[model samples]
Target: MSNESPLIQSMRTAVAAAPADVPLRLHLAELLLGEGLGEAAVAEAAVALQHAPGDAGARALMMRAMGLPTPADDKAEKAEKPEEPAAPGPSAGFDWAAAENEVAGAVPPRFVTPARAAGPGVGAPEAPLAADGSGDPGDATAWEVDTPGSVTLADVGGMQEIKERLEAAFLAPMRNPELGRLYGKSLRGGLLMYGPPGCGKTFIARAVAGELGASFMSVSINDVLDMWMGNSERNMHEVFETARRQAPCVLFLDEVDALGAKRSRMQHGGMRNTVNQLLTELDGVGGANEGVFVLAATNVPWDVDIALRRPGRLDRTLLVLPPDAPAREAILRYHLRDRPIESVDLGKLVKVTEDLSGADLAHVCESASERALLDSTRTGVVRMINMKDLLGAAKEVRPSTDPWFASARNVAMFANEGGMYDELLAYLKRKRKL
Candidate 1:
């Protein structure tokens, strides 16, 4: 008998009991490889590959056991191939010239060149403005404005305080034009929404746009950035121009920090110029943006340009925390609507999911459904999602918003200039999380 350790012997016994379990087989193969039993490891890996032919780990182990090079080694070898010229004639009974001409039309080129700006050579200076001041038509299609969204604040589940603040600071003013005009409110200022990721900032922006009965245009960092120099700034300007053309429009800039990162931290001058263009667009120079309502959302408001948050720019800031109890219940119900759920105490679920974001709530529901599915498959009988499954999922899913609050607490304590993070500070204090 072979003198194998008890652990390895037990693993071999367990793998023998579950021969179809590819993962267990792979584990045994790994143990064999670690023990210097290359032949045995290769045998086990070959069996695993028969069970799972596309398993990369099994293939790599097989290669290692057979004394062959690894994938990375093969890649490096191919990269180091010589670039010497080939002989003009065929060799070893291969008709190279005929084969090359036969497939020349069918074989596609290896790479395609990127589109360039309509200007001189790569390093030459180009005109900043077009003859008509509007950018080229090709650039205008970067973002699309939805035609008057149907989602109002009432459709939003919770966050009553956020809704009230929006009404006072933005919506109410826009609704009553006469009163706004009397108070010298230009209706062209900006509001910045800062929060953790996946907390429905974009959805809230759509609701605000719906409340105003205005076109909703969403612009993200990808829409404004380009590989070529000066194109990013022009793209930013074009987005604002599109919004201005469609008056009473809501221009929601998503991930505003990327679009307006701090100039001091930026290494590239093109990024700084993009921020400058954003500032100019927010300023609404020459009364060109009278009815354009600019709303921007960023997870890290502290990283945005100081100029972008000045009084005439994105002046008002709202801190969008995680969903409250009512919001959690609504989110859970929405996610579980299409699933076969039974006896789910949403009230209890909400209590456990405190500080969880909307996305987290959806994940909990998905996890519960998956648990039910696995149970059904094991028993060969269908089963509905239950409270036990839900509780189990909630326990497994750590709150996604915790990390965001941890970072925000420090910023709220020390770097809060002009009480910018006052709402965040108050929340943290109330929760005793500071």
Candidate 2:
């Protein structure tokens, strides 16, 4: 007869059945520890550590079995060390800061330190170079601009719906300065473009700038965020200040959700402060952002701070969806323009590439060219890209936007407030995707 108790026998059986299950092994180790079987618990914990070397639980349990201080005890000792530094020998002369640095190497970093600007010492405020190659931090004219963008709405192939919406909501007022002044409409409001990744939101922003005959200044999250306290807020201020100086400029904030995520969901005060700074800049408190037209884009607008969408801020929203048939045809032609093609039927190609984003379409073209190149190499005969290659590539490449829409559908249905996602809901319904 087995000498082990029912609980011990059952746990042994369970561990045998799930030999690779580290958590199950840890549970058994805990039970052994409770029963005062220190040796058995140490063996089990050692095995668990072998499976998950980085697991703090296994390490803590092992330390306990060895009659050593657990991580928690170490932390407690460290906390109370100043008053009673002679409690434990290991911690008596322990370098807590050095230990913390070592642990940080194993964990993912929270932030990266910014490189110091030219002519600044180690602790000086880091400033990025201006577009004019000047290191002057105060020169707002250092803001880079793609002056007189060549891509107008006319260059955008077939997003007629987007064009019309832009005209009525954004472009018309800006174009007719006299009417805008008469109606007391300020040229400082923001427009937020949102959709799946790579649906040409950035391209559309450039087109909008072109339509307004203005310069374009694109800003990403990296351009604004800084590791130093108060530096991130200052960086954001500089971005807006530069835009304001370069009036009639489109200040395009790409991936704005990262820069302005909802404060309620943020765990850190620093992130919340960054969002607040963004709001202040958007409001232009001192009329400092008079002619700078703010335009922001995000794949996940639901993550963006609600305060950013207020009336005078990024109040207006536009959905940049996947390309329609005409747009797809245009994208195909553009990608294949340099490639050798034989009798490519764009109509047939567009029909088959339904729901593909502009980026997906580009990938399809590249894949088709690669396929043709591979075939020519194998057969030792150079041949042009054909419909077969294109269609085959199209069949292999799935629409990247599908996953984005899947997530958006849930947000649109559940968390939508004040008809914020009405356009998204309508699109889903029209496409019978709801």
Candidate 3:
């Protein structure tokens, strides 16, 4: 009873007043140890250590109060004994007060937000990017499909204007920080990348992250859907939390309509609930503001929630379309950049690829290369792709946008006042190229 001095009593009183203040406890514990009150020191230090196991100073007080050697000396002694391992008990609980720098290494089967409950690292709850569409951690390593940076603007075919816009929006500002400040705009929040399928929507999203030196976290519709409403809300909150921590990062979403279909069309309670919850989490201040961006790609841009497209949410929408002739030619050079081509004229080839999308041209070039290299031990090699091989490939593969172009042409033709499809007049003129 005499061991309880006035100073120790004061320390206990202060700690009692703010029991949740882990930092204050550690400070009291360290002060007690400094004054040689080892017994009282150990008690305070032990309790403080419970809140934050990683604090080296608090840990040292515990060791001194327990009448044990310093941690360094103890580890050294243990190292001297080749046969014995240190009896370091299982880790105590983790302290989320210092929630920064905590990384959730791998995907968990299901995730719970760390704000309300302490759990292992979360893969970031914000933008779920699972392509197979399950969205959750079904497979152990099911987060992002392709690594960032691999798909450069050059890697993507066509969409040069879109590329130019992205370069100005994301790249130029990031690569030149001072210049960004001078221009008075920092890259933050959301950029909606919407386009047709296989037109490099996903590629451009990933490339933006890569070009900006940001981490990529993705989420899809399937990942956010929960049988229970409250669970989904919590999950959405957790995601934005994780995303802010992993700042200067891109949250890419593919086929976003699946997750953010027009709210008006949602028939089920689950769908509407999830969309509203998502809108709040993304558009609200509950999420981080600095360098945490959302890039959602969908074919059905018309179906995306309007709230998402409003000013601050997913404000910037870039329409990714099929490559025009010059773009198609660039795309051809890119896909065929590694492969060897015969004395076929690129200008002539470009002319023949009129009305074909970048994806369509890629398929044609790929088939041509495969056919050219099929005879030798060159499995999948393209040593000498000739004009005949390319023409043959054109016959084998069909244009993806043929039907769309036809409809567009008819619409433009009927709508035009002059006897011409004013908008598609250029494309109509190029019909002879194909």
Mark the regions of model 2 whose C-alpha exceeds 4 Å error after superposition: 1-142
Best by TM-score: 1
Candidates 1 and 2, the one with greater TM-score: 1
Per-prediction TM-score, please?
Answer: 0.68, 0.67, 0.54
**Model 1 — which ten-residue stretch has the worst lDDT?**
127-136
Whole-model lDDT, model 1: 0.80
Candidates sorted by TM-score, best first? 1, 2, 3
Per-residue lDDT value at 331 in model 3: 64
Show the colliding residue pairs in model 3.
104-121, 125-239, 126-239, 127-218, 127-219, 128-218, 128-219, 128-220, 129-218, 129-219
> Is 1 or 3 the stronger prediction by lDDT?
1
Q: Write the per-residue lDDT of candidate 2 for residues 242-292, one digit (tens) a residue.
A: 887778888989889999999999899988899999999998987778778
Query: What's the C-alpha lDDT at position 85 in model 1?
Result: 92
Candidate 1 per-residue C-alpha lDDT over 1-434 given as tens digits, one digit per residue, 9 for 90 to 100: 18677878999999889998998998888888788877777778777876786799987877786677898888999899976797675467777778889997876422222356665566422212111101111111356877886667776677788989999988888888788899987867689999888788887887788799998888888999999999999999999999998989999898899999999999989899999999988888888888899999999999998988899889999888887776676677667766777667766888998887888888888788778755653443456788899999999999888898899899999999999998999999999997
Per-candidate local distance difference test: 0.80, 0.80, 0.63
Looking at candidate 2, the ten consecutive residues that score lowest on lDDT are 130-139
Please identify which of the two predictions, 2 or 3, would achieve the higher TM-score against the true structure. 2
